[model samples]
Target: MTNHNYASRVQNHNSSIIADLLVQSSDPQNISFAGGYPDASLFPSADLADAFQHAVADNTPAVFQYTDAKGPQELRELVAARHAKHMGYPATADDIIMTQGGQQAIDLLASLFLDAGDGLAIEGPTYLGAISIFENYAPKYYEIPIETDGINLAILEQQLQANRGADRIKLLYLVPDFQNPTGITISVAKRQRLAELAETYDFYIIEDAPYRELRYRGEHLPTLQSFDTHHRVIYVSSFSKILAPSLRIGYICASPTILTAVAGLKSAADIQSPNMTLDALTYYLNHYDIDAHIANMIPYYAKKRQTMIDALHKYMPSEVTFTEPEGGFFLWITAPASLDLNAFMYDVLIPKARIVYIPSQAQYIHGDVANSARLNFSAVAIEKIEPGIRLLAETFTNYLTNHPAE
Candidate 1:
């Protein structure tokens, strides 16, 4: 009926693999765990309303106008301060480049550093958004396997050594803390090695740490950026997880040169982040203690995380194995190798049982198992978790019984 003339670069590019599932899961009747969505009810609406009002009153006409490409200086300083205070990462305000979201930071970094055919190593199963954005550039890839602890560094070393001179590999990208889809954090030892690998391989590490502060259990491991003696790690995080997702505010901390380049790239993409949001975020950060606010939300999510884990253990088939995440919204589940997870999710679960999950097919760059899914626990209500998870477990067990993994 219309023009299908998309650019050649976009031929293989698609909105994450879960896009369809997300759309289906959006139905009011469906118990969906398809999106990396934080609980909407938990947002500090009253606090933010006053914060925005204060920002608008304080800044007047300027608040309505455009902002700097690197975002509000106050907000940037706060981002840097949070890192330095929490993780002991040596990030300064000058090193910060704020973006529309952490996703934009990734895009800006990709544009600034990656060229066509340039090698960009990433965790085999990384953030879906990162894969979609990076695919547009068509950079050669080195997919490292992820372990319970984190990315397998041995494979990373082997890849780096093998591809040492072939291509202009500019960077290695990863979601180190409470990584998406899997909900696993990289180990402290791996953090040091990752920094070392960056130094030895002469490639930068893009540490996408959107959920670093969301930890409800276990010790907070040092970030990869903290281990970097040299300016090799470009650390990016967002307010989406803690404050609000709709704010569309995230900031990157790296070397001044690196951030300068990111700012330039960001400017080319979108002149700057929205002035209103930036001002509001600045006011919120200055006025409120975000850590205390985050702490308040933790008990709720902690209980929900346990709820889902318990439900999975009790109701799911023996053939299924699910992750026991310390914190974070997602839990990775692997079904028997025989079943097509999408078939189970789309045809069986969504239609029959009104349950949904993001299948593992897209998560794996290359892995043995395909019958796996990323189930999000935070979006569902505390009361709804058990019933929803029961439906998921029963449906899975029945699916396996009818069609064994033989």
Candidate 2:
């Protein structure tokens, strides 16, 4: 038998750190703050069931047949209309292409735009999945420092100015609303500044807005797409958070010029996304009030977020600080410099605390930030939140006291 080597991209890629940790500590009772999955209770199962039944009953042969490479026309129109209304952009069905999921959309975008060593500007502590996605393309990532409000404008400007490459940056990717891992939303002023910079610098912006509607507090900030008069922003969103993750339906809204190219690329990549799911999702949107469904989830997740915050306050040490996210599934926690989170997970938390969290270093492109971790409150039950956080706190306290100051 001959052994074959993996592709260079595959060989270079690190296996998903999150998946590795989850598999290693597969305890049903484990209080996991690892994955950014939505609460199962919030899934619109009844609506989806109804939609599926309706699609099956109303099924023409076309329902099961292959769809256009750009996806079902009706669903694309609906998505474009929704994007137009939400982002105050002039979008048409022609400017939208459906993909498997938000991640695939990211991959498709990377495939469409990035060549090896192309400059890609991203937030300092960004989404790990995005890091993985871009790594395969081998882009030189420029990390823009993140502040409480958004990405640091000065640093972004500096990086843009510093990149002397002839290919120029393909695009700057941003999760402007309730960003994953950190839950930081870019402010309106920053959005304007970013748009201006994009226009001046003549680079495209890929605005990944997967968590826009998950807001539990504060007013919604306008998306970067909203301010893009120069046709510089390619906005991507999914039904995963709002409807169902299994549906695997996501759409990209861009200028017709760019979107046309993306559609061709998408067709070559996967031909088309699943038609049955698109039909069902369209039926669900038409029959059900999505706003009400989302409204119901807000309080459910808000309560869970509060539970985790309260637990941390009651049990965590004074030096251990965390962000109070207004929306989204994650909270970024920073422990004292002495605490090695990987060691805490391996030697202490996993064994003693019976909890798991995504080490924050996974979020960084350069792999430097280590004294932090991400906590997901959405997946765990309200009852589990307090105990899990308490256990985590106890583990941290023990680690600090046992390994006191040098």
The sequence of per-residue lDDT tens digits that candidate 1 reaches over residues 277-335 is 89888898898989899999999889999988888888887888988888888989877
Clashing pairs in 1: none
Q: Go through the candidates in order and give each one's C-alpha lDDT.
A: 0.84, 0.84
For model 2 the TM-score comes to: 0.96
lDDT of 2 by residue, 1-406 (tens): 1225755766545455666877754578677888777888789899899999888778777888987888878888888888777778878898888888898899989988899888888997888889889988988788887899999999888777877576466589899887888888899999988988999988888899888988888888888888888888888899899887889988888877887888888888888887788889889878898878989889998898888889888999887998888888888888888677877787788888778988877788877888888888888878888888888888788888888757
Which segments of candidate 1 are over 4 A away from where they belong? 1-4, 366-369
Off by over 4 Å in 2: 1-4
